[model samples]
Target: MAAWGSTLWLLLHWQVDLKSVLIYLAVLLMMHLYTGLFITAHDAMHGVVAPGNKKLNTFIGTVTAGLFAYNYYGRLYPKHHQHHRHVATDQDPDYHGGNFFLWFLSFARQYITVWQILLMAGTYHLLQHWFPLENIILFWMLPAVLATFQLFYFGTYLPHRGEHEPGNRHRSGTQRRNHVWAFLSCYFFGYHYEHHDKPYLPWWKLYQEKDRLLKENERV
Candidate 1:
């Protein structure tokens, strides 16, 4: 919440102009931060975030998720686990027969509803009086939208989309062999086979399993 609030402050107070190099740079930074918050909340959904302390973990999940545009963690907590259990099958909310755009839309449909959009719209109506619509779009709505796409592309589409490795139990895919490229793609979620295999690790710890993931893949 602190990260989001600080970003909001920047969007509202920082003078923004197309010509202002610094403001635009800050926008990019804010978008990245938004993505990070989303990822953190995702870790919480797996019960891997600050695990062993159920209240603290759920509290962190609820708060971080709410920061990501008031999402109800109660709704997401179950659905996300279902996604993992039913991945790549028609029952999976995140999969639409490997159709990229369709699955993306399906994924959105699973989480976003007409009422939620209306709520955000209504909230914007009230907030516009205080902050410019452009700033709200630039820092607030746009980043969340981009972060969703980034998440879908890296964490969903690339990993669980099509025909995965033939012997792989999870039917998941891994990204490029390069570590920097992997991390840059989606907080090391590019090592997705590792993730489905060990969803217990938080995003930051995903890299530590790289060597093991490769070794297992080679044997399979």
Candidate 2:
């Protein structure tokens, strides 16, 4: 949360300099941090953030999810569990075996509630009064939009797309072994089969799980 809040605060106050590469870099950084917000929420939903304290866990999840464009935790929690239960089947809220754009649309339709839109519109109006409009658009708004694509492409589409290994219970595929790239891409969520195999592990520990799985495969 500190990382996200600090980055956003810096960006919102930064002077506009479109010609500078630093501005672009900052936008990308904000985008990644925005992705972190959602991933943190995802972790909270899994009870990884504050195990043994259900209220604390739910509070953290609710806050992070709300930060990510006013998403409702109560709405997402059930759907996420449904995704786990139904997986790649038609019943899975996250699944779409067809085209990427089509699937993204389908996925967006499920979560993009009217309240979220109204809240965002209202927040945009309110923030613009306090922050530069361009900063609000470029840093705050743009990053959140980009972060959705990051989450969908690396975390959802790539991991669950197309055919899976025969008899794979998770119906998931992992990225090639490259922990650094995996982290940069989507917080190591591209090591996705490792995730479904061990949902209890937080995003930070996915690389360790990946390493263990790779070593196990090597010895086979």
Candidate 3:
């Protein structure tokens, strides 16, 4: 959270050329951190953030979700559970398997609300008074939009894209054991089958679960 906030603050305040390669690096970093914000909220939804304290868990979820473009934790909680309950079906809000663009549209529509738009617009208007418009657009808005694509593609679309094997109860695909790429991509969420199989594991521990699963497969 501090990294995300501080990076955005510094980027927004810095007077640099938009065309600089540094700007591109900053955008990617911000996008990854923005994805982190959502992933943190996701952990909170599963009670991993504050396991014994529901109130604190919910508070963290609310703040993280809100920071990730004004998403409401109350609105997301039920829908996320529904996705787990009815994955890759018509009932799953996250599922729209045919075309990537079409599926992305459906997924976006589920979370994007009027209030979010209003809040973002209001924030943009207010921030422009102190920060450069280009900085706000590139550093703040563009990264968020890109982060959604990163989350949807690596986490959702790829994992649940095609038909599953008869024994694959979760109907999800796991990325190969490449922890570096996994974390860089979407906080190890690319290991989607492990995630579905053990939803309790936090993002940081996912790679450990991936290793365990690999050892089991080898022994079998």
Candidate 4:
């Protein structure tokens, strides 16, 4: 969250040429920032953050989720819990055992509530006079949309689906075990097996746990 705010601060005060046609590069950075923020909210939903304090945890989750694109954490919590409890099954709203694009569209549609769109449209309407329309679309709106794809692909579809070795606890799969790439890709969520086995641990801790588990396996 701090990094996200810092990026916004830089964008606001850095005096970049927003009118330039090449401002789309900043869109990539914004996409990443949005993805990171959503990942934080995802962690909170898993009860891996502030486990003892329900109010504080939900507060943090709601703020991050809303900032990503006006998501209500309270609404998301029940749905997310259902996903965890019945992952890769018909009950999991995120899982679609059909075509990739079709499944993705369905998954995204489930989370993209009507109120979210109204909130964003209303926000953009109010900010139009103050912020450049192009900047708002490219930096704010486009990135939020792209970030959904990034989160869905890396954090959900890839880790939970695709070709993978059969993990013991859950049927989830881990990506290539490069710590940097794992963190960069999905905030260490590529270690999906570790995550399912230790749902109480935050994303950052998954890397260390992955290594320790591998060492134990080697010893065996």
Candidate 5:
């Protein structure tokens, strides 16, 4: 569904021009909205959003990620699960990846160097030249930038740091801030500690369980 939608939009966009900037902006917004839908598919694949529906969730995730040639379900699911089990602990794969600078730099390198930008650009050009349209570059460039931003910033990089429970550091205000950013940026993925403590809970419900556990611990 996502791939088809993107292809359809690209085809339509090939015919648009500078006179269609408003239309281009509208398409850009739609693409951004679809990026959120992609995230939901990702959550479903993790079984953190739709428990007991693994097959359905996996199918949706595959389709959504497939649009960008990303196979998160096939490649990253087990790895992500491992991260959850060892989260904030030294054993966590996500934590050892890097600090802030390495995180952002690595992300930029992967995102831009990956086939995302190239594939999108090629698709647009192919459609435009084969079909012959006006102001096609406008349609192509913005969507590419938007897709790049979505994948790099929102999808891969930010979500990783959402929950910071360093095994070395006991806990701090910085960790709390990290959680806030995680929730806001990655749709509550910032509750990494809670998710780690209770992996079976759905993503939406993880925070509730976290709070419950926190209260219970405090009373002790």
Candidate 6:
């Protein structure tokens, strides 16, 4: 549904000249929708919108990712779950890297890769061309490929590490910075620690939960 809306908007504005610098900015803006879709699918996968219905959640997640040509829930959910249980501990695969400086320096080296993007794009194209619909290649597949690169850079790279609170008791500045990036790029995924603590909360409700939890903790 969201994808359809973005596609329509994109096509409606197709006559706009792509030669100017603003054209590049427009493309960048359109790509943000992909980030939103990814976060939506992530919340849906955790059954945050409707809990206890694993099949329904997985189905929705797969379809959402299919629209974007990426499947983090399918491929990365288990690892994410492990990260949740372990939190900021070294046992958390999501946070198992070196100190903040080293992690920040290796951000591009760690996650972004041309080969991974190409493989994802190629897989999407092959599936669209050989499977039921050829038009999907031009529509969803291509947009997804463009969006994936944006997702990699904005979603994964910057937020890999950072502290959220002062004194480094809970989240590092790097993680907090990541949260801000995720929030801007992917609709509030920057509140990642909150989400990890309560995966069953919807994206819209996450800030509320964080507020509630923080207040409760402060009282303690």
lDDT of each: 0.80, 0.92, 0.94, 0.82, 0.54, 0.56
lDDT of 4 by residue, 1-220 (tens): 8988777646643445767655667777888889888878988998767888988888899999999889888888898889888878889888888777988988978898899889999988987777666667777788889988888888788867754465454768877679998877778888888888888888889999999989998999
CA RMSD, predictions in order? 2.1, 0.8, 0.8, 2.4, 5.8, 6.1
lDDT of 3 by residue, 106-195 (tens): 999998999999999999999989999999998999999999999999999999998999999898999999999999999999999999
Superposed Cα deviation of residue 28, candidate 3 (Å):
0.4
lDDT of 6 by residue, 17-86 (tens): 5366755555555566666677667777677644777787777776765545445456556655665567
lDDT of 5 by residue, 136-203 (tens): 44443555356545544553455455454556232211114344555545445455455445556655
After superposition, the stretches of candidate 6 with alpha carbons farther than 4 Å from their true spots are: 3-9, 20-22, 88-91, 96-183, 213-220
In angstroms, give how far residue 67 of model 4 lies from its true place. 0.9
TM-score of 2: 0.98
Q: Number of clashing residue pairs in every model?
A: 0, 0, 0, 0, 1, 13
Ranking by lDDT: 3, 2, 4, 1, 6, 5
User: Largest lDDT belongs to which candidate?
Assistant: 3
TM-score, model 3 to reference = 0.98
TM-score of each: 0.90, 0.98, 0.98, 0.90, 0.56, 0.61
Candidate 4 regions off by >4 Å?
12-25, 162-167
Off by over 4 Å in 5: 1-35, 48-50, 68-72, 85-93, 96-99, 107-118, 127-184, 217-220
